[model samples]
Target: MSKFFTYLALGLLWLLHWLPLPAFVAIGRGLGWLLFWLAAPRRKVVRINLKLCFPHLSEAERERLAKDHFAMVARSFLERSILWFAPEARIRRLVRFKNQERFDALVGQPVILLAPHFVGLDWGGARIAMSYDCASMYAHQKNPILDKWLLHGRTRFGDQQLLSRQDGVRGIARALKAHRPFYYLPDMDYGPRDSIFVPFFGVQTATISGLPRLATLGRATVLPVVTRALPNGAGYEVEFGEPWTDYPTDDLEADTRRMNAEIERWVLTMPEQYYWVHKRFKTRPPGEPRIY
Candidate 1:
């Protein structure tokens, strides 16, 4: 039954992708809002996340944001699918990078590209790697078929995909030394493995510290970048933030805290766009029991 539904969903999605861009965009936007209100599991998750993060917000306000979030998520879903299936010419027309040379200059250097869970950031990474050497570290999705398809689509532009866990510390280090840019989404909460609790939207959250440690150890520059959703069904803004040249200290924990702080600042700038549905504070702080 599950497999049947999966194929049916995929078939419909393919048909949607085949439609004219404007039509697909309209349908996708509508579907996102529909799912936001109609899907029980998604609504529950969104509600829980919102309630936890914005305790001060009225229930009505949180519900409104959750609805907007669903719309954005739905739009992102269609946009990303289009990103995969859309032709190069159309994709190029969709998103543009400012200060691309800053990225261009690092074509030969080992660097960590920190992308928060913003719109089209993955698309921006793919575009950047087309002209330079780059690889991205992503949490492997559980569905084997979807994972395989995603891997093929992402690497179609020449960027390598590094599975977050399987790649291990050594593999990532090797990729760094190769002197090509590495892409990592900074907002994911993987586990309690060497992470530090940092203030994210005034809530203490556990975050992955691998990027800063790798940058400091490998002597690589860490550049903060975000791809924002643009108005209309067009492209997005691939804005590059200031690069981290100073690097973190030898203390792994201190460096990790600093990295989390930086990522938190970026997410706060665009609270609605960040993947708030994720249980970021799932991992409990020391001495506390698990909450979710």
Candidate 2:
């Protein structure tokens, strides 16, 4: 039954990939409206996250943000079809790179494309994979059929070497030495291990201390990669921020804290595009009540 439904969804997505961008996003937003209601558990998760992170917002405002976020999440999910099935010229036209000079300045050097968990991450990843032979980590999907589909979508464009958690940091380090830009997204609660509680939106969030370590090990400069889904269904805009000057200084936790701070700044620009449905604060500090 699950396989049947997965195939059904995939078939629909494959067909819908041919639609124009505006129509594609309109359908995705409709799906988002349905998901906002149908996906009760995730809706609750988004609510809690918004409440925790944006305490300043009124309840009504937060509620609207949650709905908009669900729409973006749906669009982000459905839009992968464009990356997977669309032609190279089509994708290149869709994802526009802003301030490529920042990345271009550090050409021939090991670089880490630190992409935060925005709704448009896959879109951004596909864009980067077009030009650079990148190395990135991916989680195994439970269903083999869906996993295979995801793998194909990610690797279709460039020489992308996707590593699972089991591959360890060593694999990425080697890839960096090989000069493949690491399309790293290290923003999530991966339990208490190797994660230090850092201030994310004033909450002591358990963030992995891997970004600094990877930059140090790989000798890679960090460039913040932000992919924004343009309003009115224009297209995606991927902006690469200026490279950090003195990153990964003597302090490890401090470096991780700074990383979280950077992500907060980016999220402020487009809160709805951030990954609100994720249980980001699932593993709270010791003796603290569970968030999800």
Scored by TM-score, the top model is: 2
Candidate 2, 111: how far from true, in Å?
1.0
| lDDT tens digits, residue span 1-292, model 2 | 3999999989988997898888867877898999999999999999999999999999999999999998888888888888888999998998899999998887788999999999999889898888877889989999998999999999998789998899889899888999888888999989899899999999999999999999999888999999999988899999999899899898998999999999999999999999999999998898999888
Q: Tell me the tens digit of each residue's lDDT in model 1 across 99-205.
A: 77777677678888888876566677766656566767766767776776677667767556564667676666778788767787767778888677876666677
Task: Tell me model 2's lDDT, rounded to 2 decimals.
Answer: 0.91
**Which candidate comes out best when scored by lDDT?**
2
Candidate 2, after superposition: displacement of residue 33 in Å? 1.5
Least accurate 10 contiguous residues by lDDT in model 2: 20-29
Give stretches of model 2 more than 4 Å off: none
Off by over 4 Å in 1: 1-4, 20-25, 159-164
